[model samples]
Target: MAAKATEKTNKRDFLNHLETYLSKRDGVDKLLKISRYATKIIIASSLIPETTGSLIPRLKSFESSVGVSRKAFRLGKFVQDINALRASRWESNHELVLLLIAYGGEGFYYFVEQFIWLTKSGLIDAKHSKLLQRISAWAELIGYVGSVSLKIRDLRKLKDEENCVASTIEISVSRGMAYEEEDEKMKKIKEKKTLKGLSIFQDLADGLMTIADIRDGKGMLSAPNVISSAGLFSAIVSTHKNWISC
Candidate 1:
């Protein structure tokens, strides 16, 4: 009877983790799509003439492509709006892209942070630990994407420096150097933050892995057995109900 109960608990924990994993994946996908659209809008507004007309149509197209509701779309717009407010004094392409990149980076960071919290809180179980691992992988991938996009922007700035050499060469050169320095600083900061986030994720992954390894090897481990049992499910359901009520 005890053995049968342990098996039942293990199965329940696995299913619970699976559900959480799927939900997190869906959330990540939605955010990634939103980020891509935001990037497009930032680039379009910066490069295209007649900002409002060009921006609105392209934004609409992106909206259609992403299939996000107006309310959800407004969230992306809110990030842009905040950036626009900040860059109101200096209207330029660089400002737009920087704001977009910062906003997107922060947004991704927050998402990962939330996932880390969820995992640490035991809201996520061993089976879902695998999903958390994947989430960490995705976070790294997103960081690389942001880095590449910033690099392209840097290259474009270099091209601009070459174009107007005679009149504003010295100033352009100085400005380019400043931009490069700033970019490097920002890149280092972002890398540091990403590493920190990855560290937290790795710690959580390690804990989950340890749990899994113990469960697989030991036929009966206290933590896994407790988490796998009906008691754990009951606690989860109760906590969820409380959350909904609150």
Candidate 2:
């Protein structure tokens, strides 16, 4: 019991350190650049040409107009807004809430694009489409929850640091992380294991690769898009990893 409590305390300390480190002037500046570059890579790779008839604006409009309840549409719109905000430059505290939003939004959209295709594929192969949908549904949910909750937490922390009144939304993000699915949960375990703060940086490479695979599998990538995105992300992810190693 004591050991587990000590572990919890250590994780909290790590979070505090992470928040402090990222809040530095340089930290925020560098991350903003990183997010901008990442968004560009994703767009150039996946969206513009692939969905020629229905790119971002069109897809977003269609998604909003889908047969759904008012509440569902509102929720979907909120999710979509996060994606739009991700590309727009913004400041964030040490928690990197904005970066998390960009990430979650990116992941969500990637899966969404695939799901849209899967919807189209239903007429051709319902069985395969159903399987893909099942797999992506959980991933989409994770991306959504992780993205929004982290952003909310970051805002709350900012409020506290800036000399504000007490907050009411007491959703402990760390605790919530404990209950995430195993594959995602395992990443959290890895986070606690090293506590070096380098692994989070490594996630850039992993995420970009995941994006590439999904785009390719969905037959959404043109030859130019594939070559450009793969080369760009590989170079960037490699440079960062090398710097971290040194």
Per residue, candidate 1 scores C-alpha lDDT tens digits across 1-246 of: 999999887664655554564364333343444444454544434454556556656655665544333223223333543464465442578755654554454355345545544554466564675565456445434444444454455555545544444334356566664345544554555544444444334334333433444344354432433322322233233333332222
Please provide, for model 2 over 1-246, each residue's C-alpha lDDT reduced to its tens digit, 9 standing for 90 to 100: 999999887664655555764665334433443444454455555655655565655543443333111112222433454665556454556335545555555455554544445455353465565466445544544454444454455445444443321121123343453333444544544434343233333343334444544465454443445534554554455445433332
Stretches off by above 4 angstroms in model 2 are 1-102, 105-110, 113-124, 161-246
Q: List the residue pairs that clash in candidate 1.
A: 9-228, 9-229
| lDDT at position 3, candidate 2 | 100
Provide the overall lDDT of each model, using Cα atoms, as 2-decimal numbers.
Answer: 0.45, 0.46
Candidate 2, position 73, lDDT: 21
